[model samples]
Target: MLSSWFRVIRVKFLLASVIAVCLGLAINWWQNQTIDLVYAGLTFVGVIALHASVDLLNDYWDFKRGIDTKTKRTKFSGGTGVLPEGLLQPNEVYRAGLIFLIIGSSVGGYFIFEKGITIAVILAFAIISIYFYSTKIVNSGLGEIFVAIKGSMIVLGTFFVQTSHITMEPIFGGIVVGVLSSLVLFVNSFPDFDADKAGGRKTLVIMLGKKKASNAVWIFPIIVYGIIVSGIVLHVLPILSLITLFT
Candidate 1:
């Protein structure tokens, strides 16, 4: 039962959001040579809660729409197998997702109180998007756009909480983080292409069809590299950050 709960939350995939938060922290430290371990830690908890909320809510909605049942499950793409397996009731999963959403929102609310309207705006967008993501955003072919923006915001938001300002470093770093995160979502969507289309969810893969989508997947890494190169050339990013190219 405990394991099922963990699967439903998709803890394994939480690392992407964690890495994004770390990049934000790293950029802030790189620029200011200062650190706030307390706020950094709090930011991480809040971001992770939001990430989990999205995952659980996504699964709940997919199941509700019957997409989860029709889709071919894969290691990377399908909704967590928990619901279809009957490890938990749909209402149980739905309630759990709400709990995580509330927890995440509470954390964001605290940050808003401390940081002001900037945090409030980002939190509001996140809450609305996450709640409707699987049902509305993906169906509109804007899913990837939202995921990418969410990744960038995580980086920017974390940096803002710590440094109380935005700068080129975090902006460039956020772009890199955002693009890479989108790539993960892009590839994962491949397996769901047919399922998504049949369910009326018009993801990028569905919009472009399989072959064009495969060809377009290369663009993500190129954009990441392009941002890195331009940042280095413009001297906005330190040359050492070029090490990202090797990654």
Candidate 2:
């Protein structure tokens, strides 16, 4: 039962949001040389809760739409098989998703109280987009874009909460993280192309067709490298960041 809950939350994929928050904090430390431990911890809890909410909700919606039923589940692409296997009831998953969403939003509310309108706006965007991501946004063929923006904002929001200001460092760092996240979603979409299309979901892979989408895979890495190189050249990011290129 515990393991089923973990699978429903997609614990491993939560790492993307973790990295995003860490990137923001790292950039804040680089620029300000300080961090508020309390705020940082709250930020992590909030982001992770929100991430879990989205994943749980995604599984619920996918199951509802019969997307999961049609797909060949794999480690990387298909939705978690928890629902199909009846490991958990649909209502239980839906409630868990909402509970996590509320927890995340409560944390954001605290930050907004401390930080002001900026945090409020970012939190608002996150809540709305997260709720609709598995439905409206993905169906519109904007899933990748939404993910990239979500990653970038997580970085921006974390930096803002810590430093009380914005800068080019977090912006560049956010873009890199955002693009990397979108790349994951873009690649994962391929195996789900048929399932997604049948469910009336329009992903980039479906929009482009597999062959063109295959060729387009190079774009994500290129954008990431381009930003890193540009940031270094412009003196916006530290030279040590170059080590990321090796990855």
Candidate 3:
């Protein structure tokens, strides 16, 4: 049952949020020449909690809308199979999601008190985005845009909490993660194209059609590499940051 809860939270996929937070920390250290382990640790936990909330809530919404029932489950794209399999009641997932969201928000609230209203703004927007993402954003054809902003904000917020100010490095790093994360959402939407359409939802896949949207996948990597190379060329980033290209 504990393991089932892990699966419900999609713990493995939570790495994306972890990576974004780490990227922010990396930039903070690179600029400030110091690290705040306690703050960074708390930020990581808060970010992951928020991420789990999004996953659980998404599962709840998808099942409610009947999208999960129609889409063929895959190792990569489909919703976690727990709800459809009857491993947990729908309300259980919904409550769990809310619990996680509250935990994450409390952490953010602490940061806002410690730091300033800037953190408050970021946290407020993030919480709002997570709540609306599955229901409203995905249906409005702005799903990809919302996701991209979500990833970018995670980096920015994490960095701001540490430094109490924003900078170009985190912005650049945020853009890289933003585009890549959106690419993940974009690609995943393909399998759900028919499911989304029938349910009155419109993802990037539904907006562009499959063939054209598939080509957009390559654009993400290109933009990521372009930012890295350009930042290096302009001396905006350290030479070592180039190594990220291989990854």
| Candidate with maximal lDDT | 2
The best-first sequence of candidates by lDDT reads: 2, 3, 1
Model 3: CA > 4 A from native: none
- After superposition, which runs of candidate 2 have C-alpha atoms over 4 Å from their true positions? none
* All-Cα superposition RMSD per candidate: 1.0, 0.8, 1.2
lDDT of 3 at 132: 91
What is the C-alpha lDDT profile of model 2 across 139-228, one tens digit per residue?
998999999999999999999999888899999999999999999999999889899999999999999999999999999999999999
- Report the error of model 2 at residue 188, Å: 0.5
Question: TM-score-based ranking, best first?
Answer: 2, 1, 3
Candidate achieving higher lDDT, 1 or 3: 3
C-alpha lDDT score of every prediction, in listed order:
0.89, 0.95, 0.90
Alpha carbon deviation, residue 170, candidate 1 (Å)? 0.8
* Runs of candidate 1 exceeding 4 Å displacement: none
Deviation (Å) of 99 in candidate 2: 0.8
Count of backbone collisions in candidate 1: 0
Instruction: Name the top TM-score candidate.
Output: 2
Per-residue CA lDDT of candidate 3, range 118-215, in tens?
98888998899899988998889998888888899999998998898887889888989998899898888988888888888889889889989888
- For model 3, the local distance difference test gives 0.90
